[model samples]
Target: MKRLMLDGPGALRWEDAPEPTLDAPAQALVRPVALATCDLDPAVLQGRFPLAGPYPFGHEGVAEVVAVGEEVRTVRPGDKVVVPFQISCGACGPCLRGNTGNCAAHPLMSSFGLGPLGGLDWGGLWADLTRIPHADAMLVKLPDGIDPITVASASDNIPDAYRAVAPQLAAYPGAEVLVLGGPAAPSIGLYAAGLAVALGASRAVYLDTDPERLSIAAKLGAEPIEGAPAERVGRFPIVVEAAGGSKALIAAVRATANDGWCTSVSVQAKDTALPMLEMYSRCCTFHTGRAHARPSIPHVLDLVATGRFDPSPVTTRTVPLADSIDALLEGPVKLVATN
Candidate 1:
């Protein structure tokens, strides 16, 4: 099998690898039908995250069950399923609480592309076929009537966006929601904003320096605000920082209203300063972490399947698995791999 391997910063290669098999009684072998890049992949490839060097390089995808382990019953061969980015055992304490990203039972658990969690580095989904542990717990079968292309991004970005906004929905119904950044973040933000509106947001404002991204936001029915931090602050009740840049984080913090919530989806590798006093004075709530993708995949899929959410407009391109690196580093919107 040929898989995408990280060679170095800004470098990707297609290399031959061993084909995956049913590794455990609860595991399954899935051949990817559609795969896409997450917003953090480029940063991880550039050595921007805490971990470094060539590993498997993708996390988002929809796959067909090629083979299943003995214990797996809910899914079988030929089932088209949405695979979440994280590797988790559904019975873990954290998973039971809906925090699958922090599942306690899956020791050393991590996705195919990312490095191992507790010293077990594994390859990612950018391959001909990959092994999925605890298949029943990890894969979500796609609902009927959903386009594979449209829901490909839901494997990560869309659900991530949904999680970024979930915590804020109850506290700020019909409040103005601000999204910061471009690319995946803004794209996810747009989906989230649409969800917010459907759930009753008064308005959704998206800010980004990229005109093209802002244009996409506008197409999603969000008010596009063009400018930098200084030009766009103090306007939204709930601000989401998806840009992964310090400046964007600052903007989200400043733009949020007093007693508001700022959910940051960017994976910041370095330390950043925050307006603690200002946040304290304003009673602002700051939240940031890896998105609990597994738990949210079902809800996101439902939204896409029912036509309540459409991410096809945000899918900028589809490339073969061989061009994974270039597609990831250069695409404007979501990039799906059809291999």
Candidate 2:
């Protein structure tokens, strides 16, 4: 088997590895049909958030089940599925409460492409084959007609965008949403903008310097603003900070309305001080955590199946799965690599 391995900062390559298999009663073996890079992949490859050398490298994918273990009843061989980024047992207490990202049955960072974290260690999914533990709990079956590109990022970004804005909209229908988008996790912010409009937000405003991202947001029905995030006006009730910098977070916090909610998906490699006093003054309900993708994937898929949310437009580049490592280093907004 071949998998993408990060040798060091700004280094990536395909490495030979043992073939993955159904190692447990609830596991399954899958052949990745399509793979997408997460917000962290580029940084990891670029040496921004440095990790140990030669670690397995990707986390998002849509795959075809090639084999299944005895207890896997929810899906069968030949079914195409979306594998959530987090590994969790559905029976765990935290999982039952919709907090599947930190399942008690799995160690911290118990996920694919995240190497050696003291658990049933799995390698990257950007390989010829991969293993899926607790398949019944971890996999979401794709609808019959859904395109792989359409649901490729559902394992993380799509569902994440759903969670970030859904609750706030539920609390305040037609609420305003503000997104600070940049190089890191641009799709997340773009997705949030599209979802806000679809869910009846009074206004969805996207602030970014990238013309490509701003255009995508505009096409998605959001009002795109081109400038620095700090150069903003009034406050918004719902905000998503995904630009991945201290300034972006600061700007997001400053632009949030009093008693508003902000969801930040940026993986801050280093600790940076925030304006705690300002957030305190606004009574802001700020949230920053790993996305619990499994619990919300089905709903996101339903939205895709019913023609409400389409992730296809976000994919601006496509390449063979074998060339993923090189494509990633090139750094396109939403690149999909298929088998």
Candidate 3:
């Protein structure tokens, strides 16, 4: 099998690797039929994250079940499915609570791809064949109506955006959402704006300099604002900071309305000074963390199947496996690399 191996930052190659076998009774072997990048994948490619080289290089996509474990009943051979990035057992305490990212049975940061985070070693999804453990919990059987290439992000980014804003809308009807976004955040920020509008937000505004992102947001019914995040003072009741820059994070915090909630999807390592005083004064609630993608999959998928939430606009290009390594290593949000 040929897999995308990351030798170093911005360095990728097609390497021959043994096909993954079903390693456990609950595991399954699936062939990647449609591959794409998650929000953090681009950052990993550019070396922004502390990832050592030589590992499978992607974690977003839908797969065709080549084989299934004896215990796996939800899906069968030849079934196409979406695998969430996080490695979690649905039977765990945290997963039962809809926080699959923090499974109590695994290491704190247990996940597929992103090599060796805290000593957990699951390979990437950019391969011909890959193993999926806890198949029933880890895989979402792709519905007949959804396109695997387009909904490739359903494994991570699309669902993350759904998780970020769906609850907020449910909690506060007609809420206003402000997405402190940039081109680096990928389609996630745009996905959030689209979800907010579809889920009944009073107003959804996307702030960014990228014409492409802004155009997508506008097409999705969001009011696109062209400016720097730091220059904005519009206090939104619900704010999402998908831009990984420190300035954008700070501005996101600063723009939260009193008693409002700000959810930051950016995964940054360095510390940046935030407007703690202002946030404290306003009694604002701020949250920064990894998304719990599995639980939200059903709702998001329902929306996708019904055409209520379209993932097509998120993808800029679709390439074949032979030419996918470069696309995986660089440029454009939501590049769909199909088998």
| Backbone clash count, each prediction separately | 6, 0, 0
lDDT of 1 by residue, 173-237 (tens): 67888887654355676666666655566788777778777777777767878876445645677
Per-residue lDDT of model 3, residues 262-302, tens digit only: 98887767898888889999998888877888898888889
- Lowest-lDDT window of 10 residues in candidate 2? 114-123
> What is candidate 3's TM-score against the reference?
0.95
Q: What local lDDT score does residue 329 receive in model 1, on the 0 to 100 scale?
A: 68
Using lDDT as the measure, what is the rank order of every candidate, best first?
A: 2, 3, 1
Candidate 2 accuracy as lDDT: 0.84
Question: What lDDT score is found at residue 66 in candidate 1?
Answer: 94
Question: If ranked by TM-score, best first, what sequence of candidates would result?
Answer: 3, 2, 1
Please list the residue runs of candidate 3 whose C-alpha ends up more than 4 Å from where it truly belongs after superposition.
118-120
lDDT of 2 by residue, 275-309 (tens): 89989999999999788889888888887788887
The total of clashing pairs for model 1 equals 6
Superior by lDDT: candidate 1 or candidate 2: 2
